[model samples]
Target: MEPGNQTHVSDFLLMEVTDDPELKPLLFSLFLSMYMVTILGNLLIILAVSSDPHLHTPMYFFLCNLSLADICLSTTTVPKMLVNIQAQNQHISYTGCIAQVCFVLVFIGFESCLLAVMAYDRYVAICHPLRYTVIMTPWLCVLLILVLLLLSTGDALLHGLVLSQLSFCRDREIPHFFCELDQVIKLACSDTFIYTILIFFVVGLYGVVPLCGVIFSYTQIVSSVLRIPTVGGRYKAFSTCGSHLSVVSLFYGTGFGVYISSAVTDSSRKTAVASMMYIVVPQMMNPFIYSLRNRDMKGAFRKLISRITSL
Candidate 1:
């Protein structure tokens, strides 16, 4: 059969995370558990932040959005994998695959942008405490979120449209559990030069820029904290940033690991496994990192739970 454009494509086969039939049940259970944890954990963060009037600041506002994004990002991938595992059918419809690609990009892009926003929030709170409320007004915060959503959705749609144009040969098996953009592109028989360029552009615009923002924000934060003179003051200021810093490290560290693994290793399976580190682990850990390290979050959660129990 001749290579056909995406229009003629009916579906693509998603490769299982593991090949062992014996391990299928284990893998299914494991992923299901993780998905549930990710959803519930992130939901709790949102509820805690929203329900508590004390938590209605810009930082917690962004935290709520971040939790929402994590929930979305995880939802974009995990549920399909669970369904495939249970059905013992790794086939994903072409439309479903394209939709997955679009959403994965959108949510991940939103997360990158949101993290940078959160970093700026910390910078304002620590470095310019007096003007923080003025600078990060409610309107400004909402505008930032709206702008990030536009940027994320626009980029995702562009990539999805470009991807839809590419033709594929008979080999339609994606080595990853879901329609990871890069993996899907690799299977295209058509020239992907434009798509490749767009990927790099989006990466720079969404990925590197946010990372730079986080770094700059933290740099100023450290400088301002150092000027506090008193050790307790310094410690207290730095503590506010600890949770965000941990999350930034986890997000970027695993992300870079995926890039490095994909670049250096010839094994697609290994690359897929590395992708899991970035995709699965951080979403599961973010709620814990924030709720445990953050006194406000812990108190909010307690209140939220008590309220729920009483209801």
Candidate 2:
């Protein structure tokens, strides 16, 4: 390998959704709108949770963090894609690509772990109602967020380091809108056997562990819900975690859809559409899901809007 070839490529050409001149404006407008909505929606959730005294509980705290993570996750890729579409340029610089990878990993990791943490919080609230306050202390919540940050940061750094070491071939065109880790890895001309195995290990460790935690938490919750004497009691208990569960399903469902669809079909465009659902759709839907399904969130937002209107 030549020493010059070993250096990171100056930029990578991102896959455009469509090549039609007429469609460029449509795509740009659509993505820009979605990005704006994602940002505004998640920000509102954070504000509502922060401003409302009643929403200062462990559940809402976790929710606020999740909203922040959603904002970061969308911001990581959508804005850049929108910019590229508007500018008629798909070239993302090497440094920018690496930054996108890091931020995306951190935000997604935060979301996954945060969802699991929220599940445990719900379990305690429903199952161990008496000790919910004591168990989910303010310090504990902060500590949990800190741990999530540390873990996400570590994982992202490891991924970035591994990716930086991988040399790309002459074809630096990534088959997706964003600098997706897997797609970038696939573009590597150099041997990626070890890195591939490492990624699988990391994916399993992060994906399985949190998913298992969520499953276990829900199992306990269901057991407790079933033991409730009244149907209304069960309903109330189930509703407490309903929003989180819905968000979790959307997140994982789209994620798996992207993975499975990419594997089954060789159509990069189809895969990119699926990836949009994975990366963009859930973030857009999360605020709506939480606010609509969770009465507390609705009340908080209602109050927030009323106060802003009065001002």
Q: What are the models' TM-scores?
A: 0.97, 0.97
Which consecutive 10 residues in model 2 have the weakest lDDT in total?
1-10
List clashing residue pairs in candidate 1. none
Report the lDDT of model 2 for residue 276: 72
Q: Which whole-number lDDT from 0 to 100 does residue 107 have in model 1?
A: 92
lDDT of 2 by residue, 189-271 (tens): 78999999988998887788899999999999999999999999999999888999999999888889988999999899899
Q: After superposition, how far is residue 264 of candidate 2 from its true place, in Å?
A: 1.0
Summarize candidate 1's per-residue lDDT along 135-249 as a digit string, tens digits.
9999999999999999999989988888888887777899888899988898888888877898898899999999999999999998888899899999999999999999999
lDDT, each prediction: 0.91, 0.90
Deviation from truth (RMSD, Å), model 2: 2.0
